[model samples]
Target: MIIARLRSIGKWIVQKQLAEVVVGLFVIVASLFIFPGADLGNLGLQMVGFLVLVVIRLYPGFSVVLPLFASGLWYTGMADHTLLSGVLAYIAIEFAVARGCIIIAVILAIEWLVFGYVVSRDFNPQVEDLPGVLFEFLCFGGAFIIGQLR
Candidate 1:
């Protein structure tokens, strides 16, 4: 019975084209091992974000609110230790674009910028930080373009 249930779940994932969501969830769990010193509090928040991402992927109607929730998580310093929050924001952005809601995408992008600024405010940010920051922006831009292409 359990095996049958697992197979049904697997079938549902394939039917829904939810491989990306599964991968995202895997990465979230992997981060716990990758970063041994990660705060449990932040991990909890990331888990919440991951679950929301899954929900949004399954039901795009939830897309509008995820960016706001992710922004709040970032603003409160609950998502600062990892890139999962950015992934959540980008996924929300992609969903908004898919639905032809450019306004939501723009709002998400602006919120992302605010999150970035808030997270980076404490640091002096030496020259070495430039590459990482640029890469981060590139990822955001790539997400937008990918959504447009789809």
Candidate 2:
């Protein structure tokens, strides 16, 4: 059953569910494109976003910059006709950046599983369970900078 598979995956997934994650990213990115006003191109943005976050995780210095770049890209694609749409675009980008951090974690976890299966390495680690609320920090901190309107 799909439910059984999900539980097994979750036991090892550590972060977000792999299937939900892929679907979530698709929904979010598709929304960005299909919502019309944003005009974001349809192709590789989601995968690129995932990789960008992975690189940022490994290199903390890029954490903010990568999100900022993604936000700028989505923002640039905006074709909204009013101030409300402008504000929404900014907030939406924030959501994208925040949610994006989690998606990258999902991809890494999946890759870890595949590589471990192939190489006979046990990739089990409680690194995920040991986590604090750093994502909250990333989201709020990113939001605050935008609040300053710079």
Candidate 3:
């Protein structure tokens, strides 16, 4: 029964053009650069999201929501005068770890904001289920990453 279901799912994915998975990989790479400090393992969640979207035929929404959420998170909790001005402040260092730190901080905030806005706007308010599901997913994922990294 499971094999039959898998076959059905495979057929569905092919019909929906799952061939675009490479583009998803490119987005992941770009996001890592733009949102530094998101290690590969963190990005793996994004990749899974992208693939699931492909399988379910909702890739666009996944793309829009993830980065926006991460960006929002960055701006809300991480960005600061210390982060923004660190580049100049750390001028003496051959490598500006402070600047890199601040930049990553900014990315995380921005990502969260984008996520909150997308879910709040796109997910139906009347039906709380979808939003609840996403919240749980984010919480679990975030906690797992923090715990695992520690």
Best by lDDT: 1
RMSD to true structure for each model, in Å: 5.9, 17.2, 18.1
Q: Assess candidate 2 and give its TM-score to the true structure.
A: 0.32
- TM per candidate comes to 0.62, 0.32, 0.28
Candidate 2 or 1, higher lDDT: 1
Angstrom error of the Cα, residue 94, model 1: value is: 2.6
Tens digits of per-residue lDDT for model 2, 100-125: 54443333333323322322223343
* Residue 54 alpha-carbon offset, candidate 3, angstroms: 4.0
Which candidate do you rate higher for TM-score, 1 or 2?
A: 1
- Tens-place lDDT digits, model 3, residues 1-150: 999999899876544544334445556566666677764444544544354334323333333344443333334543211111111111101111122333333333334333444433443334445674466456534533432332
Question: After best superposition, candidate 2 residue 37: deviation in angstroms?
Answer: 5.4
User: Over the full model, what C-alpha lDDT does candidate 2 score relative to the true structure?
Assistant: 0.39
Go through the candidates in order and give each one's C-alpha lDDT.
Answer: 0.64, 0.39, 0.39
User: lDDT per residue, candidate 1, 1-150, as tens digits?
Assistant: 999999999877754647557666777777777777778656765665565556655565555565556556655766666546667667656655655667766766775665555443543446666676787688778877877866
Q: What is the TM-score of candidate 1? A: 0.62
Clashes of each: 0, 0, 26
